[model samples]
Target: MAANAISPVAARWIRAWLILLGLLVYATILVGGATRLTDSGLSITEWQPVKGALPPLDEASWLAEFDKYRETTQYKLQNHGMSLAEFQFIYWWEWGHRQLGRFIGLVAVIGLAVFAARRWLGGGLGWKLLGLVALGGLQGAIGWWMVASGMGDTDRVSVAPYRLMTHFSLALLILCVITWLWLSLRGAPRAAAPEGRRTSILLLALVFMQMAAGALVAGLDAGRSYNDWPLMAGELVPSHYIQGDLGIRSLFEGRAATQFNHRVLAYVLWGLSLWAAWRYWGGALARPFAVLAALVSAQALWGILTLLNAAPLTLALVHQGLGVIVTLAAVYLVWRAAAPATPSPVQE
Candidate 1:
């Protein structure tokens, strides 16, 4: 704990690479979310691992792909007569998403090699990063599967809600792993959840679950049409949304209730975090609680702004990005609370 910098040892190099890898992966997920919202996820029909690398080299290839896109419900019913120029707009977004995925994989491989060569990773630590890399690879497959769901669906031009949720959940899970690893390398074992800190951890988990729920809401376009806030259609529950679909639309298919519930949960999360901070100011985890409370407030405001603006791409991305951040702060706080506490100095 000296003022001078710690020497850049082999361990430090591995930690840096791991931290960068984590950030790169999270960035890819953020871009992927933007791709979905822009209706660009299904631009290319085929999932080519090697061939997809090279984009259309000629006009004929471009037109061929455009024609294929035109055959789908997204282009036919949703984006009818969209110019080839405009088509390129969405195509690039989806392509960027794929390209980033490929880049991250390559970086992770190189980074892992460096770690292994230096003997910085061993005794299952290396395997954990390897496992994350494997997850990243599987994520590519999952990404394609989700895109395929929308390619030929009669009523939908987007992926299934559950698929979207799974995709996001995996990304969040990976981010958490990266975070835990980063903290561990920094020699910060989380302080144990204080006598009352377990409750805070539970609250944080609840907040994260709500974020996953919000993704479902966004996937269904529930936020776009639902302009009313504070209440749904001037009622507490908006009975019609829950009953209108009548047993069928209770899950992913339900739009009205999806947006409504997301709104309601935002309030709940905001209240819970704020109250925790207020009540626990003098407690063991006060700092993180306060940070979470602040983040939740900003996120709530962003949610309202996104909804009011009809979920425009810019505002919507910000809204979703902040939600993740708020969730992350909650996670970090909870982890900190659960970390083993430091002991006092020897008196004898």
Candidate 2:
């Protein structure tokens, strides 16, 4: 190996570290989804990067926290009569979510430091890891911004749908980057078909867009109302898909509109996945595309079941988890499709 080249052992260690960090990020996302589902996002009402790590230690501290929450629009308008016990329930959920974020940041920082100290992050990998840390910091801020929307002096009982969308989208973006970095660390790459590469990129983009749409659905609690699939409320489209005067904003603010959009995009993505798989069939990219298609099918079906059940915590979390898996798979396919093709063995 060249004197300046990265050690193979170091590369393997970095890959393992990234995989661990990716799983932590995945867990944080799931906890975040649970927090939103339980209406626990607004429970904290304050963002303390350091001090907030310690939850209420005694009854007085708990009361102080609960009192602050009581002043929020969510409590004032929606949970006006919530008891202390109920407040504790939601408080713990939000706390756990934030705790997970803190732990992930700690792990990332420590891992980066160790790799840098050993001079193992060669080939500009250190800069990439730094960028990830910076993104994580920004995500934490965006998280607070999302929560603040509901805490302000407004009638909203939940965070702004678009802000929530932004936060969720960024988390997935981080996860995708980690996955890409991990794949890049694997042994020498194989050549990719240009057409297949393009198709995979398009599929990944659509999948991301669908995820953003799903976040909107979650932010607006849209899935709970459109319980019936194939048709919403016995009609191909909900009668109230468009609100009276909201215009373009209705798509994000109106439950019917958000749910309808999510459904339409899911259908489009599912069809595209199948088409892409068939296009690349019998080729080097066949397996990944086929797996992508299968995951899409299962996700679409699970999404419908979640809707029919009014987005219960368990089913909704499973749907969200599956979405993450699909996204990772798409990321893998994209990576695989971009590698240089390996030369065939020389014929006799």
| Best of the candidates, lDDT | 2
**Per-residue C-alpha lDDT of model 1 across residues 202-305, encoded as one tens digit per residue:** 77777777778877976888887757776766777777675554466665568777787777787788888888888888877788889989988998888888
lDDT of 2 by residue, 149-257 (tens): 8877789999999999999999999999999888776755556666688889999999999999999999999889969878999999888888888878998889989
Q: All predictions: root-mean-square deviation over Cα?
A: 4.4, 3.5
Most accurate candidate by TM-score: 2
Worst 10 residues of 1 by lDDT: 339-348
Clashes of each: 6, 4
Q: Which residue pairs show backbone clashes in model 2? A: 190-340, 190-341, 191-340, 191-341
**How far off is residue 111 in model 2, in Å?**
0.9
Q: Report how far off residue 215 is in candidate 1 (Å).
A: 1.3
lDDT of each: 0.76, 0.90
Give the C-alpha miss distance for residue 294 in model 2, angstroms: 0.5
